[model samples]
Target chain A: MERVPILKIGDILLVSIQVDMSDQTAVQLQEDLAERIVATGCHGVIIDITALDIVDSFVGRMLSTIASISKVLDAETVVVGMRPAVAITLVELGLSLNGIRTALNVERGMELIAAHTDEREFAFDDEPDTETTASS
Target chain B: MERVPILKIGDILLVSIQVDMSDQTAVQLQEDLAERIVATGCHGVIIDITALDIVDSFVGRMLSTIASISKVLDAETVVVGMRPAVAITLVELGLSLNGIRTALNVERGMELIAAHTDEREFAFDDEPDTETTASS
Candidate 1:
């Protein structure tokens, strides 16, 4: 089975799905990504889908699954470079892609993840209960 | 102190900020929103900023804080009706508003939150381990 390549750039893991994703390929990618995130301790994951000409419900579910997995591992996932047709098709298919963050391109995805990481770190450095701060 | 009025429409809570958000007002709004969320058990919050002409760093932070509070209470926050100028200014001021969802208008915001709420409920109805389902 063909496997998706995962690249590490800075503190972010970059995965560009250039090949048609078979079910087995998607499963392998998830396992590989989980391990990569733990080994590298990366705080960001950017999935570039620009090369994908078609995205069916299965692919949409895979993206959402990847995002949820990364979230559980304390990493943010951003799906970038979705073609317009793919987006339309996902909408038509009623796959809302809930809980997944998206960006127009890879650069913006990096920026989004970086900004979020900084904000989360800053929040941590402050009082543990942010609600108290707001109340005060 | 001027208070922001929160209206309940169906299963969603809507708050339209027409006046300037003073520190005290912001604090009060947060308290009110938290209480309302608990009392009403609403799963979605739509904050309409259509009337506001300016959004400074403080306002930006207030929005993020509100979103966090809502999330903790098991509700989703969607800020809608952000004027173009306000968006540009927010970008210039470097307030990324991380974790807070946005929509072009209140109608779209409602749809976004509705879709997400349904997805969550559906996920709950299925196997709790969604990751397992995806892998299979």
Candidate 2:
């Protein structure tokens, strides 16, 4: 249980973590992840937490901070696999991660990344071909 | 254009890839990640997609599959960083990732892991020594 698994595929990384409602370990984990993210040069981060049944303001705030910090590092972040119950809990608890980005599941998250990548590439490709010469 | 920049944290590999939505790319990434997770023996997988603006049934299915694959490889996956707009879009689209795990952000994702770790540690630590048995 002391192990946190994170997998990197291309530019994206996958992470899975467990949680309990009545403890401070969640806070510690947040700080540890923030530090790890800053240390690693991954372009994107995904957090999957389907195990959590309830979330409070403190948990919500930590998540917001992590997202903010990830952005500061120039990496995009997404949340996936949210249960309706947890979503309702968060809303009822008056905890909202307004600016944080999230997806329903991992596939959507990947699509987001693909969209961004495609956009960037399209933008670059659309630039006039400086090396190509056309016969007038 | 194929890179999924989920979150960029200065350097560390926070949760990178979660679910793959790009037809072939998604499958490839999922396979690659499964292999890596099995080889490296990591415990948590975070899939963040703050960039996705849409979620379709295909993507939802893919996400669930990835979660299952990750679990088989002995790694837990947590989808993190969901956006409200996207969530609403998914609901409107009638897409659901019913059996997947998720977190709101990296902080919660990490907290989830930490809490699990603490639970195990406490469970073991709280065990009374046979020589010094105490009544609760």
Candidate 3:
């Protein structure tokens, strides 16, 4: 597994990792990541791991732990870019990530956040527009 | 599409979503996620979307964004539970998440992190054991 690389865009953080789906390196990366999340005050996070062959129980648990820690620090996390074979194996293995947020790719993950921000703006605009109409 | 659910285990938070590949909900979800990431200081993230039938460019883009944000927050993120069909479609569409961390399932993601923590402990133990042997 390669070392995880982190980049930032605006308030969002991007983490790129090359993980061997069947190795211990993946676990180490998670711990390192958790520490970073705490250190950085940025709220958004994106994880890109397109290179993986399999997934096991240990990896899943670590991810959950990371998410929990992030919440304590007031940051949000998202996972993106996964291979299909690995996905199937995970389900067949009965590995349930019941509460994790996931997207097909990183692009989609970003979109999710963008939309939310846009919606808030729209809602705010709507209130002002309605007020103008009422005043007129 | 059903709303994505945020799961909490101990101090860990998992964000899980079920996507409909044919619809635009996935994209919307991505945008929404970005906002949440910014608002919540949770770096550890898990995305489980195994129900998608197809993955397109928009979805791919969102995933990329999610990964990017994670990096900014210095958090760890993992994509889990993708279907084979969706995976093929993403690749066929030339959608690539060149730098992201991904897993087959939630469990495996946890394992990856656990293994790393374990390795660190082992290394520390080894140092002490080595000293003991030298003295003997």
Taking chain B only, the TM-score of every model is 0.92, 0.70, 0.64
Model 2's interface RMSD: 12.8
* Each candidate structure's count of clashing pairs: 0, 67, 93
State which candidate has the highest DockQ.
Answer: 2
lDDT of 1: 0.82
- A1-136 per-residue lDDT for model 2 (tens digits): 2334455545666655443423355555566666666677766777766545556676677667767777777566777767799898888877887656778766678777666556555655776452122100
Model 2's DockQ score: 0.03
Candidate 3 lDDT, tens digit per residue, B30-97?
55556666666555566655544555776666666766676566445677767788788778878886
Worst 10 residues of 1 chain B by lDDT: B127-136
lDDT of 1 at A50: 65
Best by TM-score: 1
User: Taking the tens digit of each residue's C-alpha lDDT, what string does model 2 give over B9-102?
Assistant: 2211244442335687676767666765766566666676654555567767777887788666655566776678878888888877765667
Regions of model 2 farther than 4 Å from truth: A1-3, A21-24, A120-136, B1-136
- What interface RMSD does every candidate have? 21.8, 12.8, 14.2
Q: Candidate 1, DockQ to 2 decimals?
A: 0.01
Per-model TM-score versus the true fold: 0.48, 0.42, 0.40
What is the TM-score ranking, best to worst? Answer: 1, 2, 3
In model 3, the Cα lDDT at residue B35 comes to 62
As for model 3, its CA RMSD to the true structure in angstroms is 21.2
